[model samples]
Target: MEPPSGSPDLVLAFANTHADGGGRPERFADVDGLRAWLRENGLDEAADDASPADVDGVRHLRDAVVTVLLGHSHDPATDDATVAAAEDDVRRVAARHPLVTSVDRDGARLAPAQPGLPGALGLVLAAMTELALTGSWSRVKACRNPPCHFAFLDRSRNTSGAYCSTACSSQVAMRAYRRRKAGSHD
Candidate 1:
């Protein structure tokens, strides 16, 4: 599916790499998978040197990003401790792949301090920074559905998008109805 309007393409693409609330096969499960993903995402340079360790690192980054998106959705399922841990993971990755300010006639922006995998990951972090600066970061959220916590951009007027799609919303409602009915039987 197309990324939500106003959402950073890089961030959306990177976060969704985990795929289908992680029920599906991991996109970065191995070196070959990581290389393929990097190439598809236009990070061809990183693809060449993709390694097993890089796969682990990228997966860690993706998980942290997904957790942050869940928090953005204000999903009650995502606890404070989980968000905190994710944030900490992000900080640790950021330290390893620091971004530097680059200014020119086009204005200033964050760029990677390193090359290869670090640089590619830095680009993802930069996208998050850009969105946060514009106050649109919160709009990038994960669906509330436990088995389908897909990341999406909230397009609601009040930024109240809770699920990724109507199907998820309907599923949640149906589940709630079943729960209520079951309780009524007691």
Candidate 2:
């Protein structure tokens, strides 16, 4: 599915590296996979020297990001402690990469302080920062469906969107209906 309007492509791409309800394999399963992902996302320089540790770090970052998005979706399953931990993880990773403020004729923005994998990851963080500043971060949500949990931008007029697609919403509704029917028999 196309990324939701107003979502940053870099951030969305980063958060979606893991398998989802669609059954896609982990994109960062190894160094090679991570490198390919980086290249696909236009971080070819980082891809050149990608390492196993980088793969692990990127996966951790991706998980943290998805967790945060799930929180934004207001999924009841996502508790405060879980969101807190994910936020901490993001902070730790951000510390490692670091960002510097760049001011130009266009405007001031954050840029990676380092080069290589860490820098590329910093770009992802920077995109998140931009989104937050523009109030678009909260709109970036994960589907409420347990199996799916796909990250998507909520374009609803009231920002109440909870699922990545109608398919997930229907699946969740059908499960609820089945449970209610079974409970009635019980």
Candidate 3:
């Protein structure tokens, strides 16, 4: 569905994906996909230049998303309420960033935006914006096992997917073993 305008959560969701069943990330990939999502979500469909967004613009916004994923200054006991609050934080960062929005305000409005982004870049931006409004952004996460930075959606029926891969989970188990063994000397 369409995301609220200038929403960071949408941006985050757009930029991050579990690639459905644990694979590489997927997105609009171009204007058509972007427009489809926008239209699906009832967002603005203004024509925008199809050039690549400025490196600093897209990357910094991406960093904001990554920062949140890394749980920057976040309480570890994150629940639904916490994720909702985080959506606002992402919105502010992305709205202030270059490509997302050039203007800043104490309270950003979710209005229809004009589109002019290149295929890949626009696709990413559009998806992220949509994610901000929807709870989809909440599912994006990094592996907790510490070795795997790979991102995934916590879609397990029990809402667990804390490890990126089984190997990482095994590694964490191995470390726990070493720790327990070392503690035996005490």
Best by lDDT: 2
| Ranking, TM-score, top scorer first | 2, 1, 3
lDDT of each candidate versus the true structure: 0.83, 0.86, 0.49
Instruction: Give the alpha carbon lDDT tens digit for every residue of 51-82 in model 3.
Output: 23343444444444544564522324445465
Segments of candidate 3 deviating more than 4 angstroms: 1-57, 72-89, 97-125, 132-134
Q: Residues 26-131, candidate 2, lDDT per residue (tens digit)? A: 9999999999998997788889879887778789889999999999999999998999999999999999988888777967788888888878988888889889
TM-score of each: 0.92, 0.94, 0.47
* Candidate 1 residue pairs in backbone clash: none
lDDT of 2: 0.86
Candidate 1 on 52-151: residue-level lDDT in tens?
8778878988999999999999989899999999999999998887888877796677878878887888888877887887898999998898888888
- As a whole number from 0 to 100, the lDDT of residue 110 in candidate 1 is 81
TM-score of model 3 vs. true structure: 0.47
Clashes of 1: 0
Instruction: Report the error of model 2 at residue 184, Å.
Output: 0.7
Candidate 2 is scored at a TM of 0.94
For TM-score, the strongest prediction is: 2
Candidate 1: where is the Cα deviation over 4 Å? 1-7, 21-23
The RMSD of every model to the true structure, in order and in angstroms, is 3.4, 3.5, 9.3
User: Count of backbone clashes for each model?
Assistant: 0, 0, 16
